[model samples]
Each structure stands twice: as structure tokens, then as C-alpha cells.
Target: MKILIVGTGGVGGYFGGRLAQAGHEVTFIARGKHREAIEKHGLDVKSINGNFSVTNISVTDKISDVPRPDLIIVSVKAWQVKDIAQQLKPVIGKETMVLPLQNGVLASDELKEFLPQQNVLSGLCRIISKIDGPGKINHLAVDPTIVFGECDNSKTDRVYALEKVFNDSGFKGRVAKDIQSDIWKKFISICVSAWLAVTRSTYGEVREQPETRKVMRDLFEEVTELAYKKGVNIEPDFVDKTMAFIDTFPPESTSSLTRDVWEGKPSELEYQNGSVVKLADEIGLDVPINRFIYYSLILMEEKAKKK
Candidate 1:
């Protein structure tokens, strides 16, 4: 299948490179040093599973230069969605399926407003990956699963084809019947962990500090309540399962927001925690913890800028 990865950052770089290595026609849209590196030395994937280099990949800075693809993985940061979506118009065929692996919910709806012709699939990528340097992608662990489905859960041929491609490439990819609930489950768990981990020090810090761990659990519950109020049928033990999943995080493990803060890069706060709080307020629900973290991250971002 002809595929184009709109942003060659963490999620896009790792998954797109994997698909390319598996012999699919993949082109990476990047800019500046990252784009130059991929053009000159191919894409480097660094992971615990294994490491390999692919030099046969295609690279482009302009979307018009690429052909219309069968699938487009819109993996840019939340803040860059509008600009990137505009650029992606040239590469999106009528039947193209856009799977955005953003951190929080609302990506599909947000993109649909701009590109209404293409099919938008709600997706969640469970992994910690980042562009370590110009040419290398740092894939942190083995749980790099990609879950997605149509908004209405319709069994279309495109869904099955994409699933087959993902499964054939030796990655954990599944189509959820209830993608909305799956997105909420991930959002509730991740927002809490991202806030607590970045606020305290590290995942290790939260794991060791009983108080922080308890607070994290509380934040998860609050987020879950907000989700329920928003009309998602989350599992009763969803928060517990979320806490258990977070317990496996590596000691030094951190969120993309935390890393962005430390490295003076932009963070996706408005979508992750801030969006939850915003939605909760619209529904007349209280999400103090979520609000506090959202505001705290904004302050952290400002502080990082001054450094």
C-alpha cells in the first residue's frame, strides 16, 4: 500500500520505518535536520526488540511531491494538526484512511472538520518513542501497540486491510469495536500518569512515594468519572486496571510532555488534561485534579521557556 507519514516524530518515525522495512511503499514527511538525515542516511530505528537501518525509504518536505496514498498516518503533534492537515490535502485520496495516533481523544473530530472527504479512524498508540537525534528514533519498549477503529464501528474493507498490514508486520495492532471507550480508558490512565510523573520527578518517584501513588490513583478516578459523565461506558475496574498498567512503567520512564518540558519543546497539554477539564465543565462535572495538572503543566511550559 502507498502510505505517507505526515509527521516523522516519535510515533510516525517508528511505525512508518517499520512499515517501510516490511517492504511497503512508505514516504516520510519531515523537515529541517530530521528530514535531511532521513534523506541522507535513511531512517534509524533504535529499540529493545532489535535495531536495523533502512536506506531505501523516501523522504519529502512537500506533500504535493508525493502521490495520493492509500493510507495516511497523521502523527503530528496536536498543535500542528491544522497546518499539517492542510498540507496533507494533496496526498489524501477519496478512499484514504487517516489514522492519527495522538495522545488524547478528539483528534478524529478535529481533523474531520478540516478534511471531510477522507475517512478518519480513531487511534491510540501505546508506546514511548521519540526522535533521539537527527537520524535515530528511540523506541523505548516492547508494548508499542497501535489500536484503532472506525468512529461508528462499521466493518469496512479498509479496516480489515489495515489490520492485516499491521498484524503482518509483527506488531500488536487491533481494531476495537468500541474505539470511543478505548480512547477514554487510555486518556484517563495516561493523563494522570503524565501529570504525576512529570510533577513528582519520574515514574520511579511516583512508584516509591505512596502519597504520590495515591494521588495518581485519585486523579485517574476523577478522570474516569468525567469520562462516564461524558457518556463513555468505561469498565468499573478501569481505573484499577489503569493503575496496574502504570505500575509497569520503567523507573526512569517519563511522558512526552515531561520530556518536552525538560527539553524546552512544545507540550500537548491542551488536548490531554486540559481537554478533559474543558469537557467536564461543559457537562457540569468537577475535575479539580485534572484542572490543577492542566494549569500546572502550562506553568511548567512557561518556566521551561524562561530557562
Candidate 2:
């Protein structure tokens, strides 16, 4: 399959490398030092599963340089979806499938606003990875899974074909029964952990401390309420389930948001907690926990944007 990876950071680099390893034609869109490193030394992936490099593959800073792909995996930060969608217009063919593996639930919707609805897929990825260096990707944790489906959860040939592509590429890919619910399941865990982790606590510290744990539950409940209000089918015991999932994380684990904030880089704060607060407010629901998290860190977020 011909694939275009919109961002060659952790998620994009790891998965795109795997695809290229499987002999698929994969092009990566990267910038600055990362793009330079890939063009010179190839894209290197150091994974717990295995380490490999894909040299002589197409790497470019501009999306227009690539041909129309069969699939476009958007692995950029959730907050960048809107602008990325705009830039993708020229390369998006009628049959191109755009899969957004962003952190939050709003990415597909954001894409729909700019692109054709038929071209966007609701999706999320489960992988702990990042750019370890300019052209290097480190797969630190998780089995590297991508859960995706059509917007209405219908079974389609394209969905299954993509699943086959992932299977051949050496990763777990499942067509979700209900992609919206699956997305929320991911959102609940990531949103709760990210805000708490920003308080300079690791997963071990956040889960082990009583006061912090309570705050975690409160944050989970607020997002749950927001999910319910938004008509997403989150189960009643989802909070407990999500907490259990978090418990499975390695003790020192931190969310991407926390790491970005620590490095003084722009983050998905607006798309994560900030989106929750905004969505909840629109429906007359109070999400005090999310609101607090959003407001408290917003100043820092603003400062990061300036940098």
C-alpha cells in the first residue's frame, strides 16, 4: 500500500518504518533536523520488538512533494490537526483514506471541517514512543496498536484492507466495533494521567498518593460526564476500567502532554482537557476538574506557543 505519514515524530516514525520494512511504499513528512537526518541516514527505529532502518525511502518537508497515497496516517499532535488538514488538501485524492491517530476525539471532526467526510477515519494509536534523536524513533512501551474504523462504525472493505496492511507491517490493528467509544476509552485514560503528570508526578507518584489519586478519579468522572452528555457510549464502570489500565503502566511512565510541558514545547492541552471543558460548557455541564486543569496550565501553554 502507498502510505503517507504526515508527522515523523514517535508515532509516525515507528509505524511508517514498520510499513517500509514490510516493503510497502511509505513516504514521511518531516521538518528541520529530523527531515535532514532521514534524507541523509534514513529513518531509524529502535524498538523493543526490533530495530530497523528504512533508507532510500522518500522523505520531504512538504506534503505536495508526494504522490496521492492510498492512506494518509496523521500522527501529528491533536492540536495541529486543523492546519495539517488544510495543508493536505492538494494531496488528498477522492479515494485516499485519512486516519487520524491523535490523542483526542476531536481530530476526525476537525478534519471533516476541512476535508471530505468520506476521506477521514476515526482512529487512535496505543504506543509509547518519541523521537529519540533527529532521525531516530524509540518505541519505549506498549505493543503498538492502532484502533480505527469508519465514522459510523460500519464494516467496510477499506477498513479491512488497512488492517491487512498493519498486520503485514508488524503491528496490532483492529477495526473498532464502535470507534467513538474506543476513542473515549483512550481519551479518559490519557486526559486524566496527563493533567496529573503535569503536576510533576510520575504514574507511580500519582496513583500511590491518596490526594492525587482522588483528583485523578475526579478528573475521570468529569470526562465521563462530558462523554455521556456528548452521547458517546462510555460504560458505567469505565472509570474503574481506565484506572486499572493506568495501573498497568510502568511506574515511571509519563504522558506525552506532561513531557511536552516539561520541555517547554507546545502540547495538546487545548485538544485534551481544554476540549473537555469547552465541550462540557456548551452542553451546560460543569467540568470543574477539567476546567481547573485547563486554566491552571493555560498560561504555561500560552508561553510555549510564544517560544
Whose TM-score is greatest here? Answer: 2
lDDT of each: 0.82, 0.90
lDDT, candidate 1, 107-140, per-residue tens: 8887887786446788888888889999789988
lDDT of 2 by residue, 1-307 (tens): 8899999999999999999989998999999999999999999999889888899988999999876799999999988999999999888899999999999888999999999999999999999888998999999888999999999899999999899989878999999999999999898888874565467888878999988889999999989988888889998999998888888877887878888888888999988898888888799999888888889889889999999
Off by over 4 Å in 2: none
Could you tell me the lDDT of residue 161 within candidate 1?
A: 81
Pairs of residues at least 3 apart in sequence or in different chains that clash in candidate 1 = none
TM-score of 2: 0.97
**Residue 183 Cα positional deviation in candidate 1, in Å, after optimal superposition:** 1.0
